[model samples]
Target chain A: MRHNLVLRVVAKLLIPFILLFALYVQFHGDFGPGGGFQAGVIIAAAIIFYGLIYGLDAARKAMPDRVVETMVACGVLIYAGVGLAGLFLGGNYLDYFVLDHDPAHGQHRGIFWVEVGVAVTVSGVMLKIFYMFASRGRDPE
Target chain B: MALTVIVLTRSRNLFTVVVLAGVYSFLMATALVALDAVDVAMTEASVGAGISTVLLLGALYLCKSEETKPVRKPWLPLAVSAAAGALLVFGTLGLPAFSDPAAPIHTHVVPRYLNDVLRETGVPNVVTAVLASYRGYDTLGETTVVFTAGIGVIALLRRRRKQPGAANKQDAAK
Candidate 1:
């Protein structure tokens, strides 16, 4: 438990950087080696690190199960909402070019929104999984 | 072959076995990256190296740390594994070279994604466009799988409620 103090501090320091990097990857995906999926996992990994050092109960208390569940639903809703937006604009599903007057900027806007949805869903799912395993059974050690 | 043989033959510690498994996962991740499947490599690294090792360690705390001696010959399992490995190699021989321009994968719907996604979808990154738009249904299914797993975990781990009468009896006894 004493040794875990260093791990806790390290996790605290590293997680913010990891989350920031994930956002960077999400936004800069057009030019680089990452995109929504990778960015999502990176953010999830950072949260998982926090859960590991702080204990599952504590982590769950910090983030809360209901909030994570809501995030998951919101992500899917956001993605579908964007597609519906395109549909409303008289284009097929997810046809972002029809989203605005300028097609190129519309695509950027669509990608940003979609990536946000993906990132939110992925992070929520990751934390949810960690909470599940950590809370399992009666062994608290 | 030699590494597997050593792993099979040695009566080593459980930590060693777990570490060896991690090494094997790392090797698999390297192979995925070499094949230019960066997405697969990332999942392999995160699931295999990060979550799996931690879970295994947690389980180890509840179980014995020593390996039990084998009661029978391991030759059959070895033969089976070798045959499976050979079949896998044979299967890979027919696969298209990584990033081959003329491969069927490149010539099919994938080409549409690579060539016209920018002009059509207006998304600069073709992969994101493909995942989020072209095959959004599949992505939706994958997200559902994650959601289902989360639900399963929560259901399995939730604290059980005490019966009203049982709680009252316990309180009376106290």
Candidate 2:
């Protein structure tokens, strides 16, 4: 992999675009046919592609094991926290209508955070699984 | 697509089978898009064809490439599979035709969601409104499920057969 100049150069050129596309899918999901889950997978795919081309160690350093592990939990916490926020805001559990004066805007705001949570957790889990598989049967640091 | 499946089942090499499965998933994603399920299509394409294939290939690296021949005749398993497939097809035969105007789904909660989603949530995509807002609890549950699965993987991998690094660290510290 280190010797393949073509593969390395092509991957370097493509990764940023792949990441940009993933972001598009994440935010544009409301108007189009994408959302948190799709975006998360796309994000993981880009990073996984990086790991494949560059090396597993490089990918792990780029997204450390501790950070990846934390992500697996943090995303869920963010989601549940949003629901708790709704409860504190005088709405029922998971209610979005009361977040703002205009219920529609509140819904948008709620959905955005929730989607962010989903994307974080999803990408975290996907990367975690990849790391686990890639690191199996190897010496650990 | 059927041809891909047939070839997949008949193939002996695990690597070929893995690649073929990815091809099968890609074709399935195409069919989903043709049915106007673009969101689901993206999911199938990315998760099914992309990530799962990569994971399978990774697993393949840890094991033999060729499958061992089974000693059994495989007749009973084939019969059971054929019976299940026939029963499933029979079950679908009683369902409404594709895109029927009066299908139970279109007449039921779907109409309400479609009519009120934009006004209620101000989201142009009804699917997003339904998945994230109207069915927020379900989506939260799904996220929790993913979290649980990830934790489970971590737990399984944490307990390694050997802890040479732990021993080495302790020795160096002492």
Candidate 3:
């Protein structure tokens, strides 16, 4: 793998585009067919591809384990926090209508934040699973 | 697809099986697109064809490349699967026809959602509006589940590095 110049060069060229596409799917979801779940998986796939071509150590450096672990929790916190905000804004739990002065705008804002939360959590979960399986039975350096 | 499944079942080589599984997933994703479920297709392609294959290959690296033949004939398991399949097929007998306008789903909350989604969420994508707004609580629960699963895997796999240096790595991971 180290001696494979073609794979290394091609992957280097392609990873950024893959990540950009994932972001497109994440943010453009409101107007199209893509969404957080698909975007998150695509993002994780980009990192996984990097790991496959470069090395798991390199991928870990690109996205530290501690940061990924926190992301997994923080995403859920963001989602639940939105729900609490709704409750405090004179609405039922998870009521997006109370997020702003206009109910429609509130719904838009709520959906945006919720989708972001979903994307982060999903990407973190995928990376965690990859790390676990990849590191299994390997001797520690 | 059925032939692929048969080949997958007969093959004892885990590598071939895993690769075939990815192929199967791609086929399934294509089928979903044909059914106009583009989002589901995207998810299946990414998670099923991409990540699942990589994870399966990683698991294979930790163990035998070939599957050992089971000693038993597995008749009980076969009978159970057959019974489950029969039950599922029987259950579908009562379901409304595909795309029927009078179907329970079409007649129920579907109309309301279709009528009000744009006004309610100010999002042109009805699917996104439904998933993130109408079903916000459900999505929150799903996010929680994803977070818990990540934590569970970390707890299961990261605790096994018993060396002193590994302990330092664990602290850093924290």
Which candidate gets the maximum TM-score versus the true structure? 2
What are the clashing pairs of model 2? none
Residue-by-residue lDDT tens digits, candidate 3, B42-155: 999999999999999999999999899899998999999999999999999999998999998898999999998887778988888889988887888888888888888888
List lDDT for all candidates, in order.
0.74, 0.93, 0.90
Candidate 1, CAPRI quality class derived from DockQ: acceptable
DockQ for every prediction shown:
0.42, 0.86, 0.84
Over A1-141, each residue of candidate 3 has an lDDT whose tens digit, in order, gives 855999999999999999999999999999998888889889989999998888899999999889878888888988888899999999998898999999999998888888888998899899989987887667664
> Which structure among the candidates has the greatest lDDT?
2
Question: Candidate 2 has what TM-score?
Answer: 0.95
TM-scores of all predicted structures: 0.79, 0.95, 0.94
lDDT of 3 at A99: 90
TM-score-sorted candidate list, best first: 2, 3, 1
Residue B126 local lDDT, model 2 = 90
Candidate 2 vs candidate 3: which has greater TM-score? 2
The list of candidate 2 runs beyond 4 A from truth reads B159-174
Give the chain A TM-score for each candidate: 0.89, 0.96, 0.94
